[model samples]
Target: MSDEVKVSDAEALRFHAEGRPGKLAIAPTKPLDTARDLSLAYSPGVAAPCLEIFRDPNLVFDYTSRGNLVAIVSNGTAVLGLGNLGALGAKPVMEGK
Candidate 1:
């Protein structure tokens, strides 16, 4: 039973090496197999919303991830404990958060 926590650079490197590629991915939610699907997903039908969005910037949130994504950028020159570990060491917390 101890409150202290300690980790080394080797351990961090090992953890990163053991994982699936960086953590996130994009996947299409709907089927795009037929000509209709292609039209709807990519060209003529898609342009309907694109035009709407072109007219109103607020539609960017509706048509894309602009509303939900929050980016946190930092350098480890001023990170928690383990002082000045640089950007690489600070990545896990940034991704997790």
Candidate 2:
């Protein structure tokens, strides 16, 4: 792994501000555009998998996003600015990630 240093507050802030919201996005890897796709994704066809999941709850991991998502939480009590704390204080750090 390479060592990358955070140079200046302004540079850091610029990157954060440019992406104001966050650093990652989630999108479906498969396409669902036709009637068959609709059926397979949401209706009768979907129910087949849903029933399988219902029979074995652990199957949710194989069919849904729950298996791959991550939640990063913090209280922000010790951020760079003593004046900032809580969710608002941690927003920049979270977005930078």
Most TM-score-accurate candidate = 2
lDDT for 64 (candidate 2): 80
lDDT of 1 by residue, 1-97 (tens): 9997888989866876676745455677568889999898888878987898999989988886678678889886767676787899777767766
Best by lDDT: 1
Report lDDT (CA) for all predictions.
0.78, 0.75
Measured against the true structure, the TM-scores of the candidates, in listed sequence, are: 0.57, 0.65
User: Which stretches of candidate 1 lie above 4 Å from their native place?
Assistant: 1-23, 30-46
Question: On residues 28-90, what C-alpha lDDT tens digit does candidate 2 reach at each position?
Answer: 766887889878888888888789999999999988877787776767776666655788777
Q: Which stretches of candidate 2 lie over 4 Å from their true place?
A: 1-4, 19-21, 78-84, 95-97
Least accurate 10 contiguous residues by lDDT in model 2? 15-24
Alpha-carbon deviation at 9 in model 1, angstroms? 10
